[model samples]
Target chain A: MASVNRPNKQQNHPLDDLIRKDRIPHIWCPGCGIGTIFASCLTAIKECVATGKNGFDLDKFVMVSGIGCSGRAAGYVKLDSFHTTHGRAIPFATGLKLANRDLNVIVFSGDGDLFAIGGNHFIHAARRNINITVICVNNLNYGMTGGQVAATTPYNAKTTTTPAGNAENPFSLPLLAYASGATYVARWTMLHTRDLTVSINEALSKKGFSFIEVLSPCPVNYGRRNKEKPLETLKLYQEKSIIKNGADPSELDIDMEKGIILGKFVDIDKPTHSEKYDKLYRIE
Target chain B: MTENTTESRVLTGEHFMTGDIACAEGALAAGCRFFGGYPITPATEIAEQISLRLPRVGGTFIQMEDEIAALTSVLGASWAGLKSMTATSGPGFSLMMEAIGLGLCTETPCVIVNVQRAGPSTGLPTQGAQADMMQARWGSHGDYEIIVLAPSSPQEIFYQTITAFNLSETFRLPVIIMTDEIVGHMSEKVIIPEAGKIETVNRLRPKGRKDRFKLFEPDPNGVALMPAAGDGYKIHVTGLTHDEKGYPVMTVEAQAEMMARLTGKIRNNIDRIIQTEELFLDDAEIVFISYGVSSRTCLEAMAMARSKGIRAGFLRLITIWPFPDDQIRALAKRVKALITVEINLGQIHREVKRCAEGKAPAYLVGHPGGTVIPPERVLAMAEEVL
Candidate 1:
């Protein structure tokens, strides 16, 4: 039998320079929204590098991620990156930023890593207004650990640990960020890649602590158990999400029934941790 | 940039200082520009002292939310091209185990000072104990080797802190300064040498082409050259078992290779890492092995035994880990018996016994560690062994 010869075509990914080419075929599953969110993050980094905004350069960026499926982003990114222990990406990034104020430290991790075990560090980092950007992928469950319930899991959601439906209310991450004194807070679904990229780019340029919540779908672990396919989840996000800039953070909780509020809720300039530290301690 | 001229980074000449404060000054003198720690008893003085001194030296001191964060932040700062450190007691040291493993795996250079307090859990925060000696050896879960230095006095601790930083940088792993609450709290005369007299070691930086660099590839010295975060190396550091390129490789072969590098660095360089002080061992019939504050008592007991016509020799371990097996083995063959004195209930005694290989019987003059072991008890034990 003769094999048919297909047209041979080779193309370079647009973000090839930013991605670790050898680490391709990433651990992210098919139809997983994390890949989309990661692409958006890289796109923002690419834009920032092209514009050289605030002296932004590829050499000056460092990515830190904690343990989870999304935490693998640090491994895939072609930056000076750190794949730290579970739930400690924020503190690690804080130290990195404080040690070298010239570097732009970005923490990319999952909700379970950022909000559950790492809640104290997250709140404290925000309270101090450390000059770092935190991009949290909220998949509503612990995807890496087999669809276990997470701190951000929606009320009455089905998970491996919450088979009888979740009885506890989930945290409103934007509200938490606002209460914790984050200078910049925003939320966007993976479907809103353009908006999310823009928000990430803005947060990178902003001084002080910036947090962005990315609503992503975990199909194999989360969607399969909830009777929602990846495409169905995207459709739900498209249909249910309402973009409300400067909306009250308290109303930004994830409730599909009440409509999901998205967009920049808080954006204000403030002295960052390094700035305050230098002001008080670096006196000549 | 503001020049640091208010206080000399190295406070030269004689000054009465606590071991905790001396450790802090040692850190400053050794180019430690970043300290991330939480205030814990017995160890809190180190943080307090560093907090006041670091700013004047144009360094940073951060009080993290917890000990876990404290250690992790120190690791972060180390990777960002700073000689970084943290200090804590028993409970805090327990919380820092996982991060210590991360530091080991990533081959990050930093110093961890554990001012030992009695503890199963919060045992005696204000009192000193040698209970953590064993914990310092195997506290972090894994197959790895560590360099630990036990200092007996404020002067020794100050010198050892500098040595700790140098060893950490040389080996590219976290070096622990295992001092106790007694030594940490007790004040004594410390002479800080001039800055020019003190030697500091910085991590080996990568040279040649940056793109062709493999972050974990060892040099001839069995240590990999490290590049800081913004050095344009674009390296990936992970807690996962990784390849020479610093990328995670989840295979047995990769695991073996990584483990060999991590452990081999210290094991191969054990002779250079181990330090001990010997007193009157030339023709002694009985030998005493001790470290940290307990060695002080052992020294006194040795003198008392000598006065009573018992030929007692004292061996003080300056470096605790890499266990000085060869030294113990040789000493075991030469001496009649080994008396191990420590505040803990026979931690290092077990190691001494193992290394002794039944050539010499090892007996422990141990205490549960609320207070220091009396010299009379140690002398009595030596007489009985004789």
Candidate 2:
């Protein structure tokens, strides 16, 4: 039988040991940054559970996913998890949280699911700041089915669907989350696993909607289209990504020539969507 | 407690009623503490009545921005462990389809009433139609099952609302009350039975430590014991194709098993979930199969056909999916012909045809949402097909 109490600082919960090490040579192609993002999530969950004085109950958490390669991360997790329809993970997680206010709800989705099909839910959930964590793995393209142009695809990035180059501009997720009123908003790359893990832990500990965007790699879809290998992609992210220790989110902006700046962009206080709903309903 | 006599009851009179009002009262009697909805003509009365009555009983009610938000808010309330519901017409229901799928995949038990009107897109809003029957079954893409109940009278709406919530809780699946404009607006006396007498279903929760809990772990009956958030259970649940332990499984074999279990719950329990009401069919040569308000016309036309010496019969669908295949097939074998009468062009008629499958010819009598198909029209179709 598994222990239900919070874990002590020296011991990690069973979920930490559930990751298949043999599969450690991740299926993600060399240079793809997704491997780093995946590692950060693993590291964060392990540390969160490890710090508990008693074993962290794994059953009280649910990880939700939407359509995209990043969405597949929910499958790799050995926890109560779900991989739902495209752009709809926010709502699905909302349902799970509503079903039981105690479940630690987390969403791992692709840019397409978050900004395209599920844009409404993303904004409303953030505006409502429902007590859930959303980690958007932005590879700039729809990596799963094919490297089709996605809402996050950089303007002028070549995709299978974007023959001449993407005409539409991409959404700055950190800015969007900040504007939509997420209590916690941050951005990091697969290359910066340690920092990302710290940010992820902080986001997870927050009581309101916490959003983290991991700039990942799409070796097959986004990478191949750009004629970049996995390592080259990671190199691009590491070189092009502007790192600021604690950037002011309102002042941060992406430079096409420089690339996305990665850091904790926003962390503020407001009533979480659930808290407001609780107050509104006057639930004891 | 006093028996609900006409003068003493909440609402009284034996006039013709629509399914919508019955659903509202049924919800009230079922201990529904919260309702969040937007005003869409066919489903407007449900929100209207719930808003008016919920306050009297100290239940919460809100008119949300749209159907998507309506469902989102309801899901929010449901987590607070309140029995919650929402109602909508075509376009609103379409917007809600995504959330409905979410509810099912996550095993969140909540009731949604769709007073279907015509459309691929808002074809008719003010009028009535039963065009969404198929959408109710497979509108969301995935290998999951849904329970949809169709009511023929205002009386059945009251009864079915309780049944809808019960089934939703029992199976952890979204239960849909399929009605249309005609049934939604038509009013009649529905017996507001004593609240305690009406059965309500609650999800089974695990009793042991949160450490040993597997949110999606199957019980003896294959349904997982649902632990709400505040239960102190560390349970993980997701909409992805997951193993019995509730962990998402990426393998094709794992996906196949998960899909099968998700679908098989409803298939195996069809006898328990599927319901119907047959009338004047024992000695009839032709059977008119209908549901929602259309069934009323079928009954009227069947009576006229009997008067004309045609020996016609009627089959009223109380449960639309699982599609009443067994009974329809049995009747098809015995009848000379079966006519599926509905507001849409031929939505359920296709099902009737499939069930009949050469045993008898199935005919369709439809009126696109604008006008109700008159009883005489159904009579003509019955004569032609039979």
Candidate 3:
């Protein structure tokens, strides 16, 4: 389907044609990792197309996002995109996939948008194993609205909302997705651009609900308050990173100062929602 | 539009069905191929019927996680070039309010049926009420307009549901079928017309240069031709106030233009969207104005009024959101008083009063609802008003 539609020949840059050039430079602050994550996904798609084996159908591509700094990724994509309300990217993407089997819907959203208000939709979509790829940019705080403590915020972290300090424990997103029936689950940082892109490519090629959590930096708000510079934080991530595939997601919780598990944890096959539904209800 | 009365989905012959079943059949008859819904009492039968009937006709039926996802999926399916619908009760309807706003803002055509039971917070799960009438009009936040239809019986609901889809498609808005638990659960004979005989409306599609197409740029009539995704359109759909380029434009000027187009598309053609059934309203002194289940009781009340030598009339609102303002205004002048009968205490009655505007007194014959209004009680109100 994508081969029939002519690619944009006028633009000089390969990615310029794929992104809304008029909308750049984006609203993300300097040292923000959201842009890197966005570039990774775009590069990944381009690589998938070049390989012609990673299942990237350009015409069938759809980007859906909720409200946040990362949510702007949907508008940046040249494919059919939906910028839905806050905390609704999963369900909205679910709608796109279920309505048209042809669409390869990718949900790009932030930690607060995906796990806080949109928690129910996230768990349910995973539980149903809806066929879609979800990319969660975990910034440890809500960066768009001036760094409020989110569901993924580290315990005892001082955010604007948590002036004294966060009392609640942060979520291990990979574990949440794995337990909720996601067929593929992985964790990577924005610093691991190549690996993250590969993970995205693999997830796009795979079936059922695939989730990739990208531990990203929001230095302007989260870092300045915590006294960790952007470079220092990236150094910490590089030092603490451990590549252990098939690690139990439940046992791999994040401790910023301590070692952090960073690798693909769960990957298996399962019949997706529409697959099982059609099997059971197909008519003569 | 007349042809053979034969199709796998639409049954031509008469059959006894509940309002829920009739609503589902009505959707299928209107060319709806996608059914995304969640189970809620008094409205679940609609989903169940669709789940059973849709698969046979090569249509899709997906029971979503919640009513929020149900309506969102319906919107998604509609944008994918399939007519779609979903059904829910009060609590679910509340859950769907946000999606409703998104649908209207994005100009996504879809249908939502709220088989209303008593509420404030699940006041009655199984009993019928017209409590959500006001919510149907003003439930979603923002200055926007919608088309709401009220069905009094299973047969009427069947027809009204079809009309709901037509108006939704034509205007590119989310149309609501505001039937209650009484009408939704009531079993009655419904006549299904032939497929070609049924009038179905689809959103206007883009023609001419695809490059010239602006996703949100409205034509002279204030509605842009909707282009489906994956048709090489690469359109951007958002809930935010946006420019004709479909880019978020958060300014007073941009908001005014965008919001105007979103609202004016419906308001400018309210006459085409509004439908009301006026019965024996001519040369009558006492008027009964109502909708949904309450409309049925109003008829019986009007009949009982004539038996008591009282001249009474009734105006049954089929279109609830456009509010049938002209009909109420016309009836207000010709009658001594207009008695508004509904299960909930005077929701639409306020509209009747505002429309009446001292021309006639608009009296409320209602209660805080858990059940349908009795004909005797409505008749007694008519007598008192007369």
Candidate 4:
């Protein structure tokens, strides 16, 4: 079904057409990791549209977002997209998916939107194992609003909201996703764009709730304010991230000060929320 | 429309019934193909009936985990071009407030049947009340207009269910069928109309260039044409304040203009939306205006008053919100007194009195919460006004 509708001309690429050229000189300053992550997402979405299992219908694909800079990714996409209220993209997408079951609903959210204000929905959607892919963009601080410390912000990282340093501990999104019963959980940095794209493609292919947390850089917000340039932040992630794939869940100690880990963490089969609902409500 | 005696006679058979059950039959007859709901009684029977019947008819029925998800799924189904609905009581309805707002903002046409039970917070699940009348209007977080209908009998439940869907599609807004537990759970003989007899409303679509089309841009009529998904229109839809193109706009100027368009469509066209059934109101010394189950008792009391040579009449409001103020105000001028009969202390009665103004003396016949007010009590209030 997907091949039947493919455009013969390269210029007619739907995914490429979705990107707004005028809005370029990307929102983040030079060396910021968001641009790289965005590229990876575009690649993943393109691949899904190309070789999508069950003839990936573009009309059935919807993107839901919240109120963070990462959430703005939905706006850049040329599909049925919704930028919902703060911390509400997951539930909104949940509704959109259940409404059709044919739609491939994706949620684009930031750390603050997913783990802080919208934490409850994230955990529940994971637990329910709804068949939607959630790509969480972790840029440490609230970039869109101001330089405010977030739930994923590194401990002792200074920001406008946390003057001296962030006193609170941060979270491990992949570990949380694993605990919440997500069928697939992975983490990658924007620096590893190819790897991130591969991870996204893998998540999009799998059934049930798949979560990918990408560590992006907030050059304008946290990066510059912390006196770290884009390259320095990328180096910091490189030095701190552990490459321990298939690591034991109990053995992993995600330190607040330590940088993000990058790799596929969990992949398992579980009955999706809607499928379970179908079983319970089998017609007489 | 020719009345189908077969359908009417068959549906009038004596049977034990609940108001929720009657609503389910009403929805089926009204062409409801999708049902998404969380079980909340005295409204659970509606879900149960849909679960059983939908599959038989090749329709979709889902029992969502919560009321929020239930309403959300219904909205989604509606966008997929299905006539979708959900039913809930006070508690579930409260949970649905946010999604209800989403439905309003997106202009997704769907029906929400609130089998209203007493509540401020689980006040009385098994009991009935006319509370939440104001909540239905202002529960959501934004400024928008909605159509709300109130029905008094099993017959009204079936008919109103269909009318709710029609109004939702006709106006491109979320429509609420507000029925209390008394009317929802009561089993009464209802003459169901045949398929062709019932009027159905479908959204208008634009022809010509899809790129040239303006979704939110209305013509001389207030309603803009709606485009369904898969139509290849490149339509952009959002919950945020948007221009006619349906793209989000960030200026106050844009906000004011769009809000005006949305609210004005309903306010300016109130006459086309407001519905009220007038009975003997032309020449009466006293007029009793009521809705929901209370209005049924009001009718019986009005009949008893006429037998006693008391000049009294009744106005049964079919549409609650977009209150039939013009007609009520006119009735108040002709009648010596206007009395409101309702359960719950006084919610819509306030609206009635506000519309009545100084045209006549207005009084209330209030029932505390759980119990229904018999016809005699309302008659006493009418007698006092007379």
Ranking by DockQ: 1, 3, 4, 2
Per residue, candidate 1 scores C-alpha lDDT tens digits across B231-286 of 99999999999999999999999999999999999999998899999999998889
The lDDT of each candidate is 0.93, 0.76, 0.87, 0.79
Model 4 residue A27 distance off true place after TM-score fit, in angstroms: 6.0
Number of clashes in model 3?
A: 0
Worst 10-residue lDDT window for candidate 4 chain A reads A20-29
Task: List model 3's recovered fraction of native interface contacts, to 2 decimals.
Answer: 0.58
DockQ (CA atoms), all models = 0.82, 0.21, 0.61, 0.30
Off by over 4 Å in 4: A1-15, A20-35, A141-171, A219-231, A250-253, A256-259, A270-284, B1-16, B205-208
Model 2 vs. true fold: TM: 0.82
lDDT of 3 by residue, B1-386 (tens): 12122237787768888899899889988988998899999899999888887877778888888888888888888877888999999999999999999998999999999999988887799888889998999998988888899989999988988998999888889999999888999999899888889998888999777666798888777788987777777788888888888888779999999888888988888888888888988868898888888888888888998888889988888888887787788778878998889888789889999999979988998878778778999888777766
Over 4 Å off in model 2, which ranges? A1-27, A42-59, A219-251, A256-260, B1-21, B28-39, B45-85, B95-109, B141-146, B206-263, B283-285, B303-310, B332-337, B354-362, B379-386
Q: Candidate 3 on A175-268: residue-level lDDT in tens?
A: 9999999999999999999999999998988889999999988899999888889998898779998888899888879986668899999999
lDDT tens digits by residue: candidate 4, B1-386: 12211233124344456678778877777677788888886889899877776655556776665787678768766765677899999999998898888787777888999998887898899999988899998899878888899988887888888888877877777899999988988887766555677777777777889768877887666778876554556455677778887777779998898888878778888988888888887778898888998888888898999998887888889899888888888887878888888887888889988988988878889877786889998788777756
| Tens digits of per-residue lDDT for model 4, A55-126 | 776666777788878777766666666766667777667666765677787888788988898887789889
Compared with the true structure, what per-residue lDDT tens digits does model 2 show for residues B1-386?
Answer: 12222222134334345567678778877767778788987788888777666655556676654687678557655654677899998899888887787677667778999987778787878777888998898888775778999886688888899899888878777799998877777777676655556677777777877667777666666688876554555334556666776665689998887777677778888888988887888898998988888888887898888888899988888888877788888898888998889988888899999999979988888877776789999888777765
- Which ten contiguous residues of candidate 1 chain B have the minimum total lDDT? B1-10
lDDT for each residue of candidate 1 in A1-284, tens digit (9 for 90 to 100)? 24456543656779899999999889888888899999999999999999977999899999999999999999999999999999999989988988999999999999999999999999999999999999999999999989999999888889999999988889999999999999999999999999999999999998999999999999999999889987999989999999999999988878888889999999999898888888887758
Candidate 2 TM-score on chain B: 0.92
Tens digits of per-residue lDDT for model 2, A81-188: 556666767865775565456677788888898899888889888887788999998888887777899888878889999988999888888888988989898888
